[model samples]
Target chain A: MSSPSRQPLLEVRNLRVEFFGRRGRLLALDDVSFHIDPGEVLGVVGESGAGKSLTGASIIGLLEPPGRISGGEILLEGKRIDNLPYEELRRIRGRQIGAIFQDPLTSLNPLYRVGEQIVETIRTHLPMSEQQARKRGIELLQEVGIPSAAERFDHYPHQFSGGMRQRVVIALALCAEPKLIIADEPTTALDVSIQAQIITLLKRLCRDHGTAVMLVTHDMGVIAETADRVAVMYAGRIAEIGPVQDVVKRARHPYTHGLMGAIPEMGADIDKLTQIEGAMPRLNSIPPGCAFNPRCPSAFDRCREEKPYLLPVERSQVACWLYDETGARREAAHG
Target chain B: MIAFILRRLAQAVLVMLTVAFIAFAMFNFVGDPINNMVGQDTSLQDREALRQSLGLNDPLVLRFGRFVANAAQGEFGVSFRLAEPVSRLILNALPATMELAIVAALLAVIFGVMLGVYTGLYPNRWLSRFFLTISLIGVSLPTFLIGILLILVFAVLLGLLPSFGRGEVVRIGWWSTGFLTWSGIKALILPSITLGLFQMTLIMRLVRSEMLEVMRTDYIKFARARGLTNRAINFGHALKNTLVPVITITGLQLGAIIAFAIITETVFQWPGMGLLFIQSVQFADIPVMAAYLILVAVIFVVINLIVDLLYFAVDPRLRIDGGRSGH
Candidate 1:
């Protein structure tokens, strides 16, 4: 138990995802690797199509067909989950790893009562009688801050407001007491005023349950407030990963730096927030050397020629040639 | 809830009155019923007397009012050709048509849903493709043609069943059923299939599309993530969601089966109201024709009402009151 505790709760190594389309095969995710420690929040921040949600989906083994994992290993508590049979994976899904999705308005089934959905989830992964499951389900609803949970349990999802529905969804995800929860843009569909409340509630519940969370979102403010560690993704690859504060304050990768700059500082009177010059590359048209090189502001000859992998830069692991010590010396020689 | 039902009831009543008026107007002009009623040898004076006694000379409005009043009282006057009360004639023919329609509808819905789920779930499998191809054929082929082919196969080539008529019916009170007798049950098989084939395919396609759409919803994905088994996810969640639309189509199709069982009944010579309706049309029996139309319209209106009510049961989103009572 101690040895396992020392190991990360979830490890994704060299994950590659591909989509087979009529035109040809397109690589969606390439050499993506990351891990989450027990009871830690790993915020995955990226623009849309950066594979932030895809990564979470791949972890949960729910990638829609025509898109599949071409290579990689996903392990939870040192057991390989990527290759498990569907039934085996299903058993592990809610028992060991659960998932919450975007759009709480559409997450819980509208046909069933709120409590029934949660109770069904609990019973599926755990050995409990219907009555016991219902009891546990009500308790979960209360834990997520639903008022009059026992009475509200029998109500349909539509009866609840957007924020309340999200609370229900969170409760459902946490009901099985899974070690990890893959929350893909969980708060992206909520009201702005309700966003912080949901985030705080999620943080509190996961902490209370000791459940590690892979919070995939594009909101930097959300990451700044909730995530313990942050991985900034660019073109389906992790551009930089470090302690949330370090990455936010002193971003090493140019892409990460541009993202941080894009977020407007509250009190600073600036003409405009910094904008990244070009869009992320299309999957089929990504440049050979580095995906971000064409759009990169500080692109050099080396950056345009050879791709960079994550290298230790102070506290963060940044994938940029500028942080490469040997490459810097070689650049000096060329200069 | 009561107000919603009451509103639908009022709408149903209005629709029925319109249908009744239309049927009365249309059949009233399908040539003179008096000419068909009287023989060539009958005297002109007797014919005039017959017309006067039948009140054909009454004003159109008064006649229409009388027709509606009699129809409302379940008295559709008398059939000119059979010289029998039209309502009684319909009552005698009704059991056979109803039994055939009910059997056919059950067959369509049960197998349609099963095949639909199978095709929706494993759309790429050869069996599913075969089912889809079969459904395409079912949808395209005319009902009479399908009935003839079924007869050729089962009755001619195999000699396993009778070719025509509702054989060996056992009367239980007034509702005679073919189910109790082996010959009656066997006789029913071909016509029921012929009647149900088109509706089965229609329902299959509808369910398949709905199932595919529902399977892609966030709730279904969430159900999968919640680690529900494929069976539970597919049937318990996806199938239930598909049922709202499925119910609407199924209800309408069931009504269609009853109304359009004419071709099937004609093919089999089945002693049903559709066959009676066809004979009445050929003989210019206006009262029977008008009654048949009104009856079919009533069936459609009642089915629509039932379907509207079923929506509240299947989908909670439409239930404005919410589940405050934990029902």
Candidate 2:
């Protein structure tokens, strides 16, 4: 493993995911790249079909059958993990890296008690007696703010409420003290009030344990509230990557700007909330030059003809042909 | 749970009563048992006297009541065919049939569950296809045909096993070696295998389908996501969930096995209840027929009751109190 100080905890370089759909092989993740530092939360925000969840699943090595990583180097502390055998990958998964899924109900095994599930996960990677594991399981449950943890240990998953079940799921994920945790829309399945509580609990727990998190959700509000940095995905590529405040306050890429505008502001006088003008292009029908060029407001001749690479901008990165030299000159003259 | 048990017990009683009433009505409406008992050469006066002596001259309702009372106390009058107490006749043959059915059911469940789990875990693979082919053949081949084939190959051709009978019914200190003898059990193998073949196939297919369906549940995926080995995921989690339905079908099949045992007994001539039933039916022994019908009804009811109770044990969610608590 690379030293914590010198290397990012998890890094993806030139990652490309494809699926063998009925039409043909379709690219799902086009050269997606990002790095997550230790003890940081990188929130990925995009509408459905933007490949946000796929990115998270790919990183955790849990993509379902038929969808696969085509070309990529997913480095866990500078060691490539994309090509690892399933058994070896499984060892790294749930132990070195934890995952919290969207649905709390389905995430747990209904047959087992919540505490037993936690102990099973803990004992899988750690050497501990049943009694010791049980003790630790109770402690983790209490840490996640489940009341009467010892008493609740014997109750099955269905006995718990939705918010409580999500807590149990989080406890299961944290049982092995993994370095990186991938939470894919963890709060979406929850009620509005419970959603805030869980988000707060997760942020606090991750901070206390120094665990890096990849929080994936379509809710920009959640990203603004909980994420340290935000990666804005459009179609299959990262259109913008920067600190949450900067990205939310001043987005550079046109797609990112449209996404920010689409967020319903509090106390707005508008009759209806703004929506993005066009639908996400079909995976097979992705445009030639830029995947988002058709939806982008600042599409130029070059934007239609040549794809834009993610290039460094002020304190972040933006992929837009309008940021090129000629386009910049036009903007400067207008300013 | 107690309420559920009580409800099931009430249903069992109703079913048994219905079966007894049908048996009684059918037996009385068919013909006189006395006429069958007395030969054609007997005088009309002698026949009348015999009918009066056997209480066949009594009212049909009264005779039916008497028969039911006697059956409840384990008496079934005298079998016209066997010429002995129907209870003793049943007792003599019951063990052999019970032994055969028990062993066959046990073997079917064990082998069927093994094959089913294997096939379900690796579906569309060679092992699955092989088991599927064997199951198809088992289902198509009739039990008597299988029995004859086995006897031809193993007994006549190889001379390895006894072809028929419970092998001399050896006396051993108060315990008769009816089924304990090697030759007696060896004779049982072919018939039991034939009797169990279709049941085994049915059970295997049910278990395989249930297991495959359960394996696709999210909990199984969750188990896999926990990094559990394939064996642990397949057996510990998936198989346990599949067992409730498998067990239910097994209980139902067991009842069918009892009914099918009559045909199997005649084919093998194993001197079990089925053969007794056949002989009684041929002679028109009404009391014996009623007794056997009641016994079969009791067995079916008891098995179903046990299965109902087992459902609660297997899935805690099925407990009546558990359901009520949800509301």
Taken over the whole model, the C-alpha lDDT of each candidate is 0.91, 0.83
Error of 1 at B190 (Å): 0.8
lDDT (tens digit, per residue) of candidate 2 on A218-327: 89988999999999998899989999999999989888888888888889888876666889898888898877888777676667777787887788888777667766
Distance (Å) between predicted and true CA of B6, model 1?
1.7
Quick one: best lDDT, which candidate?
A: 1
How well is each residue in B46-133 modelled by candidate 1, as lDDT tens digits? Answer: 9999989989989988888888898899898788889899989999999999999999999999999999999998889999999999
Error of 1 at B315 (Å): 1.2
Taking every candidate in turn, the Cα RMSD to the unseen true structure, in Å, is 2.4, 3.6
Model 2: lDDT to the true structure: 0.83
TM-score of each: 0.96, 0.90
Look at candidate 1 and tell me the lDDT of residue B256: 93
lDDT at residue B16 of model 2 (Cα atoms) = 76
TM-score of chain A of each: 0.97, 0.94
Q: On residues A222-315, what C-alpha lDDT tens digit does candidate 1 reach at each position?
A: 9999999999998888999999999999888889889999998879999998999989988888897778999888888888788788898887
Off by over 4 Å in 1: A1-5, A328-335, B39-52, B323-327
Interface RMSD of each: 4.1, 3.5
| DockQ of each model vs. true complex | 0.57, 0.35
